[model samples]
Structure formats: structure tokens, C-alpha cells
Target: MPLRNPCALLPRRLQVVASLTLAVLLFILLLGSHPTSTSSTDYIHRVPYGPAIQSSAHQLVENLPQIPHDLPHVNTPAWLNPFRGPAHTPPPEQANSSSGEARWYTDFKWRNPFSSDTTLDEERAVLPPLAERARVYTYFESTSKDDKTKKIELELLQVWRRAWWAQGFKPIVLGKPEAMNNPLYRAVQGLELEDAMEKEMMRWLAWGNMGTGILSNWLAVPMAAKDDTLLEFLRRGEFPSLTWYKGLESGMFVGSRGEIEKAVKEAIAFPAINTTKSMFEAVGKETFAVEADHGAIAFYSSATITAKYPLLATKLSSPSTAVQGLALLPQLINSHLHTTWQNTFSSGIAVLKPLPAHTTTLIQPALDIARNLSQCPSTPIPASCPPNKPRCKPCVSNNMLISVPPVLRNTSSLFTIATVPHPYTLTSLLHSRLDLGVKFVRRETDRDSWTVAATKELLGTGLSSFSRLPALKDFVAGSYGEARTLWLVAEEPVRGDSELDLDALDWHFGFQLPRSPVSDGKSVTPVPGPERRPPPPKEEFGEGPPLSEQELMTERSMFMQAQMILRDSATGSAKGKTRGGSKSFAQTREVVEAWNLADTEVWRFVRAWDARRQLERRGWEEEEEGFLGKGTFGRWIDKIT
Candidate 1:
């Protein structure tokens, strides 16, 4: 008793020590879990590489940092922009990068832009001169109305010039025989392809040279101007600047706000469903009286949940008529021939919902057979499809009309009226390097990286399908003489500021949204920088009050420097409350309808739905019968059977 057993005492002592050790370890683990953002340029990608600094390599991804901690409000810290999610957090510092020219041909097989420095031979190959006169882009005010098709043509030709995309770059885009000169091509042209080929073809056809329409698009200008230093105007198929001259036919010039607005407007379109009285009797004799609103709700929910389709909207706006009437009077005969096809196929649905299991049971079978060889593989297809042939898998039914058709099925007119043509004023202006842009007095790389990171994340999260997802073209479209600094904007939505009215009728929600930076799948990492306060915003708009969120977005698009600070229009504040507003019955329904019309987009979800159908098509016939009759996508069909 006097001396406790020595062994026992030793055991007790060891137990105490072990408890203490465990506690300490837990403390360290907890501390490590706490998010701590360091103010360091360690993770920043400061590439001497041309313009773009968003790192693509995985190792360059810093720790997946939560949205930055101390970003200046004026910097319009991305975190404050509500609607951002965890995946949107910036990557912690330590991301490293060296000044390397952006390798243009990284993914493509034929091109290797990164192998060696830009070789003289390669450079020459991309930009071959043809005519003695190099083409120069010119911006002008048009006296007539905007021409939609012409606008696309101008943009298409210019993009080819800048990106060095030729006819070869264009995938067959649907080759099989068509009842009307490629229904697939016509169906997706303006709404998707942007009519690049038609513009080139029109140019040739107008000149009585139908055979060489594509050749004309090559834009064969001479290597050098008469003075010899190479045409100062054209480079590698691109004419950056719009040549300003008299009698050059007036063209449309919508401000930066207008372009952005066009984008947003397209996001808002939805099919109008008649919320009139309709009776949906259950499979049993129990028929309940259904209200119009209830019917719409039921139909929309059933369509979305069953098909998983997202509605889509398209901007129906025409480009400004700053320039009209071609220099070479467009041949009426050829114009008719080229445009006739477009008119026939120029239409697309703004909203298309998938059929319910009951309807799809009848329709999808036909669609699967009809669409068997027209869709692209590799890319995920819409929800409804037969298995094994995702690329061109046939649908269960083809003659099955969509949930509802808007302008798409409304072509009661005899001629397919394609939209008018307009030039790519924006790109042309930039190519010429006319040197129009606000000068950034200070340099801030950190700000730029953050902006790029957020943009990439958004695109990856499904915004890529949006027609107006801003990319390399939107950011660096126009030329700024040696753009030194990019602005990190915290410009908020304040009333009474007037430089740009993003809320103006056509300029509001729908149009402005087109330029929203997209997010690709990339870890969010803070941009590196010397960390100085951004200089006072240039007073280009005079002593007006601070601009509202919409206005700020428009201005940012035009300037192309500052990262925009937008209040979620769904919630008119920048406090990062993360709250989303529910539109009224009508408004909300519209968005749902928009999601349904997504032939190309909502198709992924539909394909998912269709996979269930394929599963149903094969065997599983023993499943239960009747409405809930265990159609495709039936989870317990086999179990029930």
C-alpha cells in the first residue's frame, strides 16, 4: 500500500501522456483546416506570353483558396458578386508561370504553335497575301436599318482572319443528304454556326462565281501595299481597323452596352404556353379539375424533371445599319438563291421542352430512328436518345413535335426570310489597331488573373452553351496600343450615373448578359500582383454619379480592361448575400420554358432521359403496365417487374 505497484503507476503515467499527445495532434489538424489566404503573388501567372495569363496546367493551380479575403471594394472583389459558389474560390498562391507565348495549336494535330518560336515560314503560311490592295476594316454610320445576316458575315470573316480558321477548321457540320440543302446546317446556322460559310458563298455568288465562293473568303490580298512595307491594313486574313471614309454607306453602331444587352436578351427567351383550362386526368378514373397555372406548373415541372431540358433564348436584334448597300451591288438573283435556303432553315425554337414519359413513349422511338446519323459524337447529346450511337443515335420518334414551338414553326411565309447582313465592326476596329481604348495608368496582374480565373470557372459550370459566353475574342477584340494594365473593377450599381444605361429597353438583362465571362473547369486562383490601389477611374463619363451594375458591366465590356462588378440582377445588391429571387409565376415559367427549348443544350439531360428509354426499349418488358407503367428512366421497373 505504501508503494503502489510500480508497474501500475507506469501504465497510468503512459495513459496520461498518450491523451495529451492526441489532444495536441487534433489542435494542429483543426488549425490547418482553417482557411488562411496569404497576400502573395506566388500563385500568379505573369506570362511574358501574349496577353492571356490564365494558367491551364494543373500544377500551376495554387491551393484551392476560398474567395480572397482583403480585396478592395473598388477592386470589385469577385467574391462580392453574389451567385459565386465554392468552386469559384480563388486558388491559393504558389501557382507559378513563366513568360511563354500562348501556344495556339496545343490541342490541334496539324498545328504546333508551341514547338519553336513563331517561325518565319509558319507565320507566312498563316498569313498569305493575294491582291495588291490589303483590306482594311472600316467603322461607319449607316443610313439604313441593321442587317442581321450581313452582321454575321462580317463577324465570321473577321474571326477567320484573327483565329486563322479556314474552311478546313469547320467540321462537316452535317453532311448526309438533306431534303433542302442540309437541314442540319440551316437549322443551326445563325443560332449556332454564325453563318461563316454563307457569307463567303454570298460574296462569290453575288459576283457570278458560284464555283469559287469559298475561294473568295480566303481574302487574297497582296502581301504588301503599294509602298511595300506589307499592307499596314491587313494581316493574316484579318483587317483590324474599320476604314473611316465618306460615302461608305451608313452602318449600325450599337455601343458596347448594346452588344452586351444582345447577349442577355437571348438568355431570357421562353416559349409562351397557354395557361388555359386543360384537364389532365390521372391514369385512373379519378379526374381532378386542374387550373391553368397548375397545369403550366405541372407540365413545366414534368417536362424539366422528366427530360432535364434547359430553355434557350436567342437575340433577335439586328445589327445597326451604319453601313448598307454593298459596294458591288449584290446580285439579286444569287442573293435569292443563297437566302432562299436560309429562309427555309433560318428558323430555330427559342423554347423546346422534352416530352413526358407518356408522350416520349410514343414520340422518342420515332426521333431515335430519324436522328440516327445526324448528331455529333464525343459531345454529350440531349437527354432523349437510343443507346450505343450517341453521335447520331436515332430518336425513338422523329415526327414527334417538341413540347411547343415558337418562331421556329411559324414560317407560314412562302420564302425563308434570312436576316440581313452586317459587318463585324468591332473586330475590324481592333485589327486596324486604330488605337481606341482607355489608357491604364497603373499595372495590376493580380486583378487580371482573378478575373480570368472566375471567367474560366463560370464557363466550365455549364455557361459554355450560352451563345454569348465571353472568351478571348471579347476581352482582346479591339486593339489598344501596348495594353499595359488591366483594370480590376468594383464598380457597383448606383443610380443617376449615365455613361451607359444597361437597363434601357433592349439593352437590359438579355442583351448585356452575352458578355458575361464564362467559367471553364479550372481551380480559382488569385491573380498575382505588386498590390497597389487601382488609380481613380478615368472620368470619361463626366461628373455623373457612380454607375449601376448594368451600366458598369456595359462600360467594362467597352473598355475591356476592368473586371466588371455586377449585382446579381436576381438580387440588386453586391453584398454577397447569395440569395436568388424567384420570378413571378409567369416570369419563372418563362425561364423554365427557355430551358426546354434547348435542342443543343437541354439535350444532354434529355439524353440522360433517353438512356433510361434505351434501357426500357430492351427487355424490362416485364415491368408494371399503365401510366406510371415503368417507361424509360424507371428506377424500379425491373424491381416491380
Candidate 2:
């Protein structure tokens, strides 16, 4: 039927469409029958070289002697190894060893062909005893020529000595006079330098002449001084010269005595304009620098020096800055502060002043009353008195006196008694008793403590309304002694039909009660209960509101305040009193001074933390486009959520 002109049955347009379809089918069949040439050309274009070159290379490889199946494959390119040699045959003594071991021995011998047998034996031996090699020397020069600077330098040396001693290394701090006496220093002192800075920097070279062990800057605190592998390597006689940071050799380093002396002497002999530059360059290979900026100022200085002298660049063994920069600074500061605080505040007893709202004018009067009642003579009953005579309690009962604050009188009984063998012990005993009473009241009551309740109530009125409260204004403006008065009260069981007087206590403590039981004595005011709301509708799509600056600031403030309070409480100020009760007035004052000093440190840490956050925020802002697509808004959303 196709042969009988099938197009004749169709219209002109249909005939034209049929003809076009037949042509396309024929073209497809032709392409399918002979796709080899096209595919080959495409593959050749995709590959590295043309078909002719590939074939020639393949032929050449095939004609070459085949590598033994037992031979290990190397990562070298085929072109580089055009003439593949036979596998290396080890000596009969090493024939039993593995291929890798043989190769290592070969490489070692090739690298150190001129090494003596004794030197090789020493290098192969295990690390020597730590006592023979654990010496770390540092040079201490006061940046300023004042007595205060000298004192600070001495303190820094003491800190360094303690730190290194803890790490099993004998730390030596060399001063200017000691450096001047050293032959190495004398040798370099005569050399002309471009400026005073170069002359000052030349002192570091003396450290190299002092030892075969590690040389460290005064500010370079050790992080891994006890690392076994590192110590073992450093103890080796043939150990290579190692530098920290960007290989500037200014922070810390360790090497053989000869290598260090050689580097130092070479640096001194070299007539360079900048002696510091020459010294750093002549040192050794760069390893890793400390990541922290705490006591690692030496590493930073080295990095800066390297930046200024790009010619000293070398491949770093490790890219990481060793320690955590953000966390370590505050940790070091806190550690130092804690040590000082413990030394100053270790007394068994201390006197703590109450917060501003806790102090009251009533404390002195109560003290006077207690003193009088304690000293009152007891009444004695006459032996001849009749049995019907009414018996009365003594003025001073059981040799103890009790005092109660008016606010707590209806709700609870409060008393404070201190017993001591000697009159001199009375003051500490009284402080202990009052501290215990204050703690007991605070723990038993619900936000009824003067400071807590008053502050909450004042804050509830809003920041703008603070001026409306005259008591708060006076509390803020009053003297420290006037504002922080102690109220001696002890919790006791309430007797009789007395009920808790919440209203009276709240009024006394300056707390604004949220609700009253009765309004004007006519109608009862309903207490507001927790409101019940309907469940939120399920969100099909869309995001919540991004964290605002106000919310961020509020959260940061709360976090910092909580940290400060926790740190303060950890100092044992909130621990009431010790059982020994032997602290004198001077000891108490020392305790107070310690707390003040610690508080200052805590605030300083808070400021540093805030500053770090600001720096991180600035970094995020700078990288917003690449990191967060929507800039600041996106960054905030990303960070908060």
C-alpha cells in the first residue's frame, strides 16, 4: 500500500506533513546507524588529549616492561616515572622488614648521609629523663623604668614561675643585670642597631645562649607544656629548630643547644637594619601559635612581625591557633582573681552588710533594748514566801534575750542569742547569730525580704515612674550606712490565734501589693487569676518576629547579672559564718576588701564579654550579604533563632 503512493489519498497539507515526517525518520535512522565517529570525536574533545596521542601513549606503555604485582604503587605521575626501575632490594639484615620500614630507613639514610653512627644512635634512642631537659627560660624587662613597673614585672615573674613549675619545668626569669652578665648578650650589645627598639629586642637572643631547652617570652603561658610526645621530641639531641606562630620566632621555641646558639649568633652577625627581623628570620620552622589572646600577647606580636616581614613566611605545620581565644581570656583572669581572693578572704568569720533596703533606723534601738534586757538582774523568789503567792518569770530568762521586728511580730516570733566563753568572742558570735537569722528569714519567707520585695515593687512601677516613689529616691540618695541597716530577727513558731500580717509587712518593706481583699470596706476586690486563652491557630507558613535590639539587650543584661551574682555567691559571702568564729576585725575588713576586689574583676569580665559580643555582631554585619541574604534582619533572625 505504501508503494501505491499513500500520499495520494491525503490533502495537500497532510501530504506535506507526511513527507516531512518521513524525512525526519530517515535522518534519525542514518544518525543511529553511524554514531561511532561522532561519539568518538565528542569523547576525544572531553578527554585530555586527542585519539592519536592517546593511542600512541597506550602503545608505548604496553611495550614497556610490566610492573610486578607484588610491587607497591606510588602516587607519582606516569610521565615523571617514564623509566620505571626495579623495586629496591634491601640488605639481607633488613630483608625480613616490611616495605614501608625499608623505605623509611632508605629515606632517613639518604637525608642524613653525613650523620655519624653515634649521632644516629642518639637520634634513634628514646627520650632522655625530663629532669635533664625540662628547663624553660624567659627574659623579663620592665617596659617602663619606674618602681611600679618593676613591681609589676616581679609579680609577672612570680606568676610565670608558678605556672611553669606546675608543668614540671624549671622556669628561670632573667633580668637586665643577668642579661648584661651573659656572654651572648655582651656579644650582641656592641652591634649597631637602627633604633632603641632593636637594641631592646636583642635581649631575646641571650635566651638562646642560656639553654638547650625551650625559650619563651614572659607573656607566653604554656598550654601543652606537659605533652608527652612534644616533650620527647624536644629532648632529642638532633631535634629541629621549632618556632611558634608564623615562624617569626619571637614567642616561644625549643631546639638543641647548638642549633639555637647557631641561629642566634647568625642573627647577631648579620648586619641587618632591623635586628629583630634578622633574629626572627634566622630561627626555625613555624609550628602552631596559641589561638587565645589572654596571656598570648607574644604570639600576637610574632604574627604582627611576620606580617611586616613577609619574606619569613613558611608552611605552618598546623593552621589552627591552639587555644580558644574567646573563652580563655576570662578564664585566666578569673583564675588569677580567685587565687588572690582566697588568700585574702580565707578567714573563718566575716561581717557582711545588708543591701540598701534591708537597713533600717530601727536596728540601733533594737540593739539597745537587747543589751539592756540581757544585763537585767534576775528576780529571786524568797524561801519563806507562801505557796499561794503568784510565781513570776525572771527579767532575764535562761540568760538569753529576744527581739522581734514589728512587721513580723503578729505573724512570727523572732529572737537572736549569741553564747561565747569570753567577752572578746562576743562580736564574732553576734555577727554569726545575725547572719544566721537573716538567712533563715530570707529562706522561710516568700519575697518578704526588704531588698527583694522592695526592688520588685519599684521595678513593677516602670522605669519612667521611678521618680514618683519618694522612698526609693531617698534609698538611692542615702549614705551607705543609712541605706544598709541590719534587722536582727529569727523565725519562731507563731503562738495563739495570730495570722500572717501580709499587708502590714508589705507596707513596712515598701512593697506595693497587686491586689487588696477589700476595696474601701464596701465591696471585695476580686483577685486576678491566671487568664485562659484559646490555643493559637496552626501556622501553615511564615516566620515569627525577629529578635529586636531591645530584647537582645535585655537578655544580655540578665545573663551578665546572673553571672555576677553567681560569682559573688561562690566567694562564700553568702555562706553565713564559719563554725570556728575566730576572725578578728582586721580579718573581717580583709574579707570585705577581697569581695570588693573580686566584684571589680567580675564587672571587668562582664564588660569584656559585652565587648566580645559587639565585635562578633560587627563581624556578622560585615558578612551579612554572603552569610545572611537579608542583611541585618536576616543575621538577627539567624543568631536568635
lDDT per model, in order? 0.22, 0.35
Question: TM-scores across all candidates?
Answer: 0.15, 0.26
Candidate 2 achieves a global lDDT of 0.35
Q: Write the per-residue lDDT of candidate 2 for residues 1-641, one digit (tens) a residue.
A: 33778788999999999999999999999886855557667766776657878998999999999665347866675567769874433332222112211111112232221212213321121111113326677765545444443444454444454455433355565545445555687666676665554544445555655656677776554432133344344434244544443332456666666666666566666555354443555433332232222221223243542353222222221234212221222223223322221222222111111221212221322333233222222111211111111132222221232332222111112222111011111111222222222233234322212222233433443432222233332232122211122222211111111223322221112221223222223212112221211111121121345336565455444434333333344353433244445323333333332323322222222222223223333343364324332532211112211
Candidate 1 lDDT for residue 339: 23
Model 1, span 276-307: residue lDDT tens: 11111101112111112111001111122224
The TM-score between candidate 2 and the true structure equals 0.26
Best by lDDT: 2
Worst 10 residues of 1 by lDDT: 415-424
lDDT of 2 at 152: 41
Q: Residue 151's C-alpha lDDT in candidate 2? A: 46
